[model samples]
Target chain A: MGTARANWAFLLGYRFYVAAFFVFLAAPLIAAGSFAFNDSLFPALPWQGFTLDWFFNDTEPKLGMFHDRRLLRGLYYSFVIACGVSALSVFVGTCNAFLFVRTDLPAKNFFYIVMIVPLVIPGVILGISILAMASQFANGLEEAHGIELGFLRPGLPLVVLGQFSFIATITSLVITARLRKFDATMEEAAYNLGASRLRVLTTITLPFLRPAMIAAGIVAFLVSFENFNTTLFLVGSESPLTITMFDRMAKVGSTPVLNAVSFFLMIGSGALALVSVLVQRDRTKV
Target chain B: MSQRDIKRLTLFLLFAPFALWILLLIVLPHIGMGYLALREKIGPRQYEFGFGNFVEFAMEPIYWNTLLRTGSMSLLVTALALIVGFPIAYYIAKIANYRTRGAMFLLCLIPLWVSDLIRAFGWILLLRETGVISSSLQAIGLIDAPVELLYNDVTVVIGLVYTVMLFMIVPLVSTLDGMDNSMIEAGYNLGGSGLTVLRRIIIPYAMPGIVSGCIIVFMLTAGSYLTPILLGGKNSSWFTEMIYEQFITRYNWEAGATFGFLLLAFTSLVVWLGLKLSRQTLAGTVARS
Candidate 1:
């Protein structure tokens, strides 16, 4: 009876500790969510009255977030750049994963390490390096050929390219992890049964890799969208949402509009993550 | 040519995109950065080949001080993470029921689902003088006044630890999960106390996870710009801040590249040493396991 009581006490203690940890992890997110609906402009002390004014009401200072053209433009730019980065990364990462796992590539270890180099190197460094190279290339082109590539001059393309340097590494690692677990015997058997490599790959390997591809693509999009260090160097005059938000915070004090934006993003990302988790669970069950 | 040669050629062709991308986008640019770092910043628009930039970085007391600060900060964060993460990892791996373990693991990973920006923002909210933590502490009379918590080195350390803790935890969890629980039981059965069993069996078993975790957390904390930028404020600056100023504000690409290369070189050297140390520790753990 004493031992049973002791076990119960231990279990209760463990449960409390676990709960505390969860609360610690979740508190910031919850606070941000609450502050989004807060009536006050500043994140001042004492709980202000609740209002959806930041989200819906359009006025001079708090320009109804829905109608805020600058914020919308920033969001649009962020989405477009993220999409470009994700697509490029997925393409290159998938190909790299295929080469690493399924193909007979010479000096595989060297390539693998080379592929992961960008990940270890700081983002700020990568950003500056890419910018320097691009500027030099642009200068030489203009001097020699009298040709202009306005898009390449520290804008969306540069942002996508800079982001791709790291995003591709992430995608490659994820797809590679998935690929390592894949049973290659099926592909071998298919080839042995007189199937062409292309057919075997397309019908078998591609389908098998599709889930990882999607996950990698989504993660790449998120990384690019939220990316600051590299994007700061390559954004030029245009701004992504994160950059816009950061600039606003730096210039002025905190605003409820920023909170509203963050809250909406949190909800949106949470929903997407939930869906992905469900899909992953279903896949595992299958 | 044989069929094998054709297959190898096909594979090489398949890998062409990655090779080209890495060679041009990463390797070439890094080499260029290294070269730029050695050059002199002649003007806002010009650079001449010299070692003046390196000399400038070396001569600056602030540079060395920031480097030391960043290194020590990373080390402290790694140690804090190990303390917080190990018990949780141990509990999940060895003690918890299967369902509970899964749930606990997911709980740990939830923080990672949020972007680092949002996470840092969360800390900003919590650690601000008029923020939740201070308010609660004040309300509870823990202090006479709301303390200056944000924009300090302590806050920076907390933010770094919170941000990089999961990096330590996940690797540790994976390593510890692979460990056999019966070893601990055997140690205990041989008249060893719980502390002895833990020290003799569990610590050695989890050493790889701990080492790898420390390396990853240290590297991440050292290289991290966002957490330090947001939380550390202007007064408490890291080396990366200097790099940012050179690149963004001054437009001194040569100096910026030089600083970046120096930071990279230092971090790479540390990581290389960490890898060697961890390999030895991991081997010892494996032998014991």
Candidate 2:
């Protein structure tokens, strides 16, 4: 009876710890989501009466949120850049994974180390390096050919390039983790039965890699979207969503509009998480 | 086609994209950065080949101080993460029931799914004056006034640890999951106390994971710019901040490239040493496991 009582006591203590951990993790997100509906100008202290003014109403001069055209543009730019970076990274990363796992490439280990170097290198450094190279290229182009490439002039293309530089590494790692489990004998047998390499890859290997590829692509998009260090250096006058939000917080303190944006992002990410979980479940069952 | 020809062609096709990516993105930029680092800035847009940039970095006390501070802060954060994260990982991996373990693991991962910007902002909300921590303290009469918590090293360290804890925990859990339970039981059965069993059996078994986790956390915290930028404020300057200023405000590419290379070299050296040590320790643990 004493041992049973002691076990119960221990279980209760552990349950409390777990509860605290969950609360700590979830409280901020909940708070941020709730604040989106707040009518207050400042996000700091006293909560003024609840209103959906930030999301819907635009009657007030300084208060209404949807009137902020800057935020809308930033969001649009972020989506476009994220989509581009994701597509490019998925293509390059998938090819890299195939090479690493399935092919007989010489100096595989050496290339693997080189590939992962970007992961260890800081984003700020990568950003500056790319900026320097692009600026130099632009200067040389002006001097030699008397032409200007506006896209590469520390804005959209540069941001995409900076993001893709490292995001591809992440995608490659994820796909490679999945590929390590692949049975290559299937591909070998397909080849022996007169199926070409391209057909075997398309039908067998590509199908196997689809889930990991999707996950990697989503992760790459999110990483590029949320990136600040690299994007900050490369972003000219125009801002990405994260950069815009950060600039607002720095200059004029936090606003309910920021909270509204956070709320929208939270919902988007949560939906993505739900879909990924369902997809993973289906894949596991298959 | 012959088998050899087919194999060669297949290898070329497989490696083509990756080779191009590495060549264009990684190799070419580093080569450019290296050249820029060696050249002296004659003016805003002009350069001449020299080691003046390296000399400038070497001569600057502020640069060295920032580097030292960044290293020490990273070390402090990495140590804190290991201390806090190891127990949770051990519990999830070895003690918890299967159902509970999944939930607990998810708890650890929730912080990771949130953006770092949001997480840092959350810390500000909790730590700033009239924020949650201060308000609660004031309500409890623990202090007469709300304390200033932002724009300091304490907040920076807290932010770093909060952001990087999962990096340490995930690797440790993966490593601990592979450990056998019977060895720990045997230690306890042979007149060993709980502490002895933990210290003698479990920790040694889990050392590789711990080491790898520490290395990863250390490298990440050392290079991280956003957490420090947001939480550290203007007064608390990290080395990366200097690089940012050079590249952005001053447009000093030479100096920025030099700083970047120096930071890269430092991280790579630490990684090399860590790999060497972990390989030796891991060999022993692998034999035992």
Candidate 3:
């Protein structure tokens, strides 16, 4: 609208600032990923010829992330946890959406605020609180009846619960937003046409909510995969990839192999995010 | 079955999951944590409920000081993210070509998709003494010695601002996107300068988005553990670090719970203050997203 009277100097400065902002966003990630290919032992710039050793080497000084048993196991643990978390979060989240959006539930506003509490609190506190409750429950059980509950200890189950507590809130937000936009009259019309409630839900409403469910699932998966603060407190002997990587980084500083892991994570998360965006776009168009 | 029976069934199905989630995850845990925090260790295996843990926190200067520092640093990070993110949000929302807006928005989301740990690792690669930036400066003869740029407050702020940038931008863009172009044109036609129009019309209209963005950025920054530790290094002195120490290192659950609650309480207070100052409700703040 102001093109005819736009300030040239301001425009130039604005362009420069935007360009710099993009660089600021991208530079660290690119720099980190570049070192993955560096042949140097230190992940630094000496222009030592690029090699696949960081990703391929098997032994000792230059162990590849793929070959590192500990890291691979950690990745496997993270995957299993992510799967469990996403499934639980999406299921519960959908139930939550139905409860909040479609029903004339009592104290709905109070419940809604309670649901959001998990999202606002620190993940560290979330992890700690879950840990405390589980341990206290476990301890009381042991004290009163000499009973032991393995899941109540710092373990994968607790990790899943901690992650799910907040991740479910995200999924609920997603599913609820889409559900709020849904035309409930369609279900009423189906009922008028002699369709059962279950039939209407499964055949019509579920199909409509599929995209939001899928998008929320993908988001839940990604969040669970990369989670650290919560996982750190609740993890048992078997560490997640984030914990493993952080330990390695803290103990031994930067290695090209860690950089290699970063590169793959960037690609993996980027692809999933792209899929989520496309799914949401598809929903919008529909 | 009667209609009453069907209604009962539906209610049971819906209320069960929601009740289980809130009670088991949210309500019980916080209650348990509160119990833990209130305990005073009287003997090896004996405990009694008291406010000793909270009292200790108030009595210790180092503890309270670290808490204050973490709060202030988070505030600074929130401010910085808003300042850095506003124009970019404006660009994407109003200035970018309609066809390219989606693509531009995607570009912003790309960095955030990568985990916070990886993002911090990237900063390490760039800011470390032997990292790219210092090395490049050396290669260009800008300096003779490698500068250790990592493990500092500035680096931590930079990492945090970068981490939370997308959050601020998204809400701002959404709010700004709803702004009518005719209003800006009206402002211009009325002889209002560009800066005046922005301050009066654009910002006021985007105030909800701005407040929400600030709230999210502040919450994320305050609760953040990895960025402050990884970027600020051993001297980070972040309050979360103290809580971590109490829980993981010292095995002092009582003290840890106390610190955790203090962090939660203070951050909530700040968030409440922020909402009040901006005249936005918590629901409204969250709704903007």
Compare the candidates by lDDT and give the number of the best one: 3
* B-chain TM-score of model 2: 0.92
The sequence of per-residue lDDT tens digits that candidate 2 reaches over residues B216-252 is 6888788888789878787677888888888777877
* Residue A202 C-alpha lDDT in model 1: 90
Question: What TM-score against the true fold does each predicted structure earn?
Answer: 0.91, 0.91, 0.97
Residues A1-286, candidate 1, lDDT per residue (tens digit)?
9968987998799768767766877887777667777777675557788888878888867665687888888889999998999999999988888888878677877677777767767787788888878887787799999998786599988999999998898888888877887887888899899999689979998888888888888778777877888888898777988888887766666777877887877776666656655655654642
- Highest-TM-score candidate: 3
Give candidate 1 misplaced runs (Cα > 4 Å): A1-16, A192-194, A282-286, B1-6, B42-47, B138-146, B280-289
TM-score-better candidate, 1 vs 3: 3
Native contacts retained, all candidates in order: 0.50, 0.41, 0.69
Whose DockQ is higher: candidate 1's or candidate 2's?
1
What is candidate 3's TM-score for chain A? 0.96
User: All models: lDDT?
Assistant: 0.79, 0.79, 0.90
Steric clash pairs (candidate 1)? A58-A64
Q: Which 10 consecutive residues of model 2 chain B have the lowest summed lDDT?
A: B280-289
TM-score of chain A of each: 0.90, 0.90, 0.96
Give per-residue CA lDDT, model 2, range A140-179, as digits (tens): 8999999998876888888998999988988998888778
Judging by DockQ against the true structure, name the best candidate: 3
**Candidate 3 residues B27-140, lDDT tens each?**
899998898999999999899888998898899999999999999999999999988999999999998899788888888989877889999988988888987889999999
| Candidate 3 lDDT for residue A117 | 75
